[model samples]
Target: MVPGIYRPRAVDRTLDRYRRSFSAIAIEGAKGVGKTATARQRAATVFKLDEPEALAIVQADHRRVLDARPPVLVDEWQRHPPIWDAIRNADDDGAAPGTFLLTGSADPRDAPAHTGAGRIARVRLRPLSLAERLDAPPTVSLAGLLAGDRPALDGDSDVDLERYVDEILLGGFPGLRRYEGQTHRAQLGSYLDLVVEKDFPQLGQRVRNPDALRRWMTAYAAATATTASFEKIRRATTSNDGDEPARTTVIPYRDALRRLYVLDPVPAWRPAAGSLGELGDAEKHHLVDPALAARLVRATKGRLLDGASSGPAIPRDGTQLGALFESLVTLSVRAYVSAAEAAEPEVRHLRTHRGEHEVDLIVEREDGDVLLIEVKLTAVPDDRDVAHLNWLAGRLGDQVIDRVIVTTGRAAYRRPDGVAVVPAALLGP
Candidate 1:
């Protein structure tokens, strides 16, 4: 029996809705995002491939596990990637909907022969959103915005800047949420350590110098929300002798990290059908979770409260806390947007070549309509805060479905020009 509380995930609804039509569904995310527990709730018989006994059985005959029951779950299925094709073959044999469920923490070392496109639907399960983490419910729905319904933006959350700092340090990992102080800090530290020491090697790329990899990771963490170039990060991880690893050497590290789902950077947005004048191609740096980033830079709540910044490893526009807040918002937006699968919006970042204008988050519909949002770590958003939103609105005209400034403010309201000002706590899926 799975023990402990199961906080309802936003993806639960999506999983339920999709499994009805698809034969299999794969829930993918970073480790410890509660993928197993969430899948267990729907599974009858589970094959935990990570375990020796279960793996031994699968090795003996892969079909043995499949014979246990229908609606069978194969946890850590990436451990034995052939199971993916086994399930795919089952689907090819006309298996009933929702017959097989697979959950993976990281991508398999060997890629599956088949893509499982039509037979198995893949849903991304990310960390908990602000609404899931907090007691008070969100007032504004992301789905509503995507629908262009323009619902009333009215509600309040006591989750201020200080509380946001607490959330940033606390992180969104379900199991680790209850820990505080040094214990919590240590757990996050160990999580990062495992990523470098174990997770990377498991993904088929052995780090010859773990220390160098850790430094690179720390430097990347320091980059957080900025679009800091790879050259900058390479220099930051320089050795004491002032020698840095070759760019060729560091390239594989990012590939490995990405495959492990450690880095979740937002790609630059390009309008599908327009000349938007030199949209930057660089991706905005972000880890899977903000707390992991905070832990990498050793950002304590007290230090963050004091407006302390991390190492000069990467150049940043504002404070680390602010960047983290944007990251937290990005996570929430992705979660909310993912849940709105019917009219799912593609979330990306926007930046010009000269860096004259930039918006933190862009939610673009399949039809190319967009909802632009700017995340601020402040209580009240004045005209200065909404300047970029205004600028983008002028450029995009009616193509801009909505403009928003997400802040740590108390209330959710809109300005005279129709740009919505929303508190992060008050926004939901």
Candidate 2:
């Protein structure tokens, strides 16, 4: 176990649930999101696949090696696909419970092409959200209001926007957190190199020019916090020759990044009552860590502080930071949902045909209730800020139980219309 750090409540909650109900739990996320650390801290015994000795032992007798350690924690289980079957067999025999905790960065596509049922309970591990880092108070009481509780709105608190932006630029990766000065840049540079050199190859892609891929990654970074079409990305990266790769190439690379636990795509959400044909079908792209996006922009702390351009500046309109803020809110909400052991909430973007209205996020509950959320970087709330949410509430009637505006502002209060305007800082775990 790593010393000198408080356990993340979200992770601890997940571990508890795994111990109670599931024989095996798969903790998945992008690289450096703390899966290995969390599993190691909670597991009674751990077998690290990256170790040569462990690899040899598994290669010799996979079943014996796994069964040898009851309540085993297998780090990077994807490295040994046979072990998945072994775990399944062990579980089927009802030999014991809490026998395995599997952690992997690779997706099912890279995992031997088959993952049988009842093998594991899966959880998508994301970076430490702002609320998790702050160890925020339980606000699901407020979240519960969306389910028809009509709870009182918790007052908001002040947050330093500049520092918050810095956190975002620095990202949530634990490794990057320790480095200072140019060392941080060097570390992130090495990270990019590994993604291009090592990770891409592992995903079974044959890139003749890794440098070109790196360039494309940089271009994507510049376009981060915005809704850019994949075709546009292709045009930006493709060579003059018609022989350039298709938009399909972008998907694999993006998926590989996602599997590695980096890139995150924010899907557009339309109101359930609205006609599907009216809403736009575009997904806004966001890096799993906004700091990754900042790195992609090639911006330094000095550059960001100076408000100077490093690469192309991401627009500050409704489409850019607004989308990023929504993604941040989603990440926070996901952490909360996972901690509660409640039904997983689905996040969707809202839009209409005539462009009459739009909402940043729509959290769809399992019971068909919807919570409409709007995100803003500004602290001061205005009529324009909750305009879309109010419109949706009016249209959907009681179906929209809660309307919230998450912002960087100083105070949290309820508006006359019963919508809550909350500051991001007060949004705790």
Backbone clash numbers for all candidates listed: 0, 10
TM-score of 2: 0.89
lDDT of each: 0.87, 0.69
lDDT of 1 by residue, 107-218 (tens): 8769697889988899888888888898888999888887776666899888878899888889888988888899999999988889888888778887888888878888
Q: Which stretches of candidate 1 lie over 4 Å from their true place?
A: 1-3
RMSD of each: 1.7, 3.1
TM-score of each: 0.97, 0.89
Which pairs clash in the backbone of model 2?
A: 30-260, 30-261, 136-428, 136-429, 156-412, 268-349, 269-348, 269-349, 269-350, 379-409
**In candidate 1, residue 317 scores what lDDT?**
87
Q: Worst lDDT window (10 residues) for model 2?
A: 312-321
Shift of residue 36 alpha carbon in model 1, Å: 0.6
Per-residue lDDT for 1-429 in model 2, tens only? 134464464656766776777788888887777888778776877888878888778878876556565678988887777788787777787756567888987764646544655567787777777766653453434346445665676654545677666666666666567776578777877887887887777767667767557656766666664566666665666554544556666777767777776677668776555533577677766667766666766666565545455553444345444444555666666665565446666777776744567777787777777888888877778899899998878877777768888887766778897888777667654
Worst 10 residues of 1 by lDDT: 1-10
